[model samples]
Target: MCCTNNCINTENPSGNCVKGYGYGKLIDGENIKYINCLEGKCFDQYILVYAENSFKAPQNSLNYSLYYFEIKCKFEREKSSVWMNIGLRNLNTNKYIYYYANNAKIYNEKDEAFNVSINWKNNDYFGCGLVYPPSNMTNKSPYVFFTQNGKEIGEEILLKDNSESYKPFVWLKSLSVEANFGNNLEAKPFKYDISDHLILK
Candidate 1:
């Protein structure tokens, strides 16, 4: 069995929870169990793994929580100089599960310094991430959407494209975004985890 929200008798490691993430053990082109516990969220930019018994009881426990993370990106050119803030929230329980930050400073096309912060909150369980640039440069912004079972279920757009990234509202399990640019007007789609940072390329 796989470690997921839909698992039955989730009290212990009854299934392959470790494989649910990305760090699967390698053995003869097969995914072997490498970790013993698995209970958390997966953001495209990062992954938060939790303990099996950490999940709150459905009746008396918060059950849901929210987390937060912050990051900064400074490029040699003004084009890449930007800051990003991310959060993971569970509204039902009003708790935070994880929080992080990544601050980057670049010099001469080289990454000079990077700062990161990670933490867990016990308030709510709401999702958050880079919502995208604002809503001013409609033509320059990319298209963002949510997906489930390999199918798109919801969509959102960033009308502004001036900034390199934006703080998202909630944490999404499976998401995909595409950027349309150039004379060809090509569409480039990217798959991301539940993390707060995503590459526009």
Candidate 2:
């Protein structure tokens, strides 16, 4: 598990600012972040952030309320086909909202995956915030938005959920990407202030 504050990756990349998750292990030592990607080897690797309730604010933990991330992916060895995913994973209800660096998609409670319209790339700033549906008195889901160099690229998409705790997740296949989880994203905070949620730092 790498802490964003002290997860100094050896042989680090130049000017590579990576965000920290509560915990991340080199998936097969192949799939890695910018710091470890320099030395780690693997074509198909995955980094997962679990929806652990114990991971909360005031500590290096994960939260479901409000989360912001700045992620950049550099193609090290481009293959004939590149498959990658950066999204929120909720296993409890077997649902997921994913971005493929080019497009975005989501899976409903019944595990039905569908495509979403989005314009994205390797380097972009992503913000996920808690949204309580006006119609739902109790149901609330997180909405994800993408930006490039401070310019909004696409419309914010509301994720479909079914009472599942979603976690920041990554899946790489012949790709290399790194993320920043607000350990340093001070100037760029979530637009709406969140009071009840926890911060993942």
- The best candidate in terms of TM-score: 2
lDDT of each: 0.25, 0.44
Clashing pairs in 2: 19-179, 19-180, 19-181, 30-41
Name the regions of candidate 2 deviating beyond 4 angstroms: 1-31, 34-65, 102-129, 132-161, 187-201
**lDDT, residue 159, candidate 2:** 60
Candidate 1 lDDT, tens digit per residue, 1-201?
A: 233453323243233333344222222221122322234543112122222112111222222221112112121112222112223223334333222222221111111222322322222121222233223423434333332222322233222223232222221111111111111313422222333333332
Q: Pick the candidate with the highest lDDT.
A: 2
lDDT of 2 by residue, 126-190 (tens): 44333333332235444554444444344455665443355666665445555555444476453
Model 1 residue runs over 4 Å out of place are: 1-34, 38-140, 159-201
Per-model TM-score versus the true fold: 0.20, 0.49
Q: What shift in Å separates residue 15 of candidate 1 from its native position after superposition? A: 21
User: CA lDDT of 180 in candidate 2?
Assistant: 50
- State model 2's lDDT: 0.44
Q: How many clashes would you count in candidate 2?
A: 4
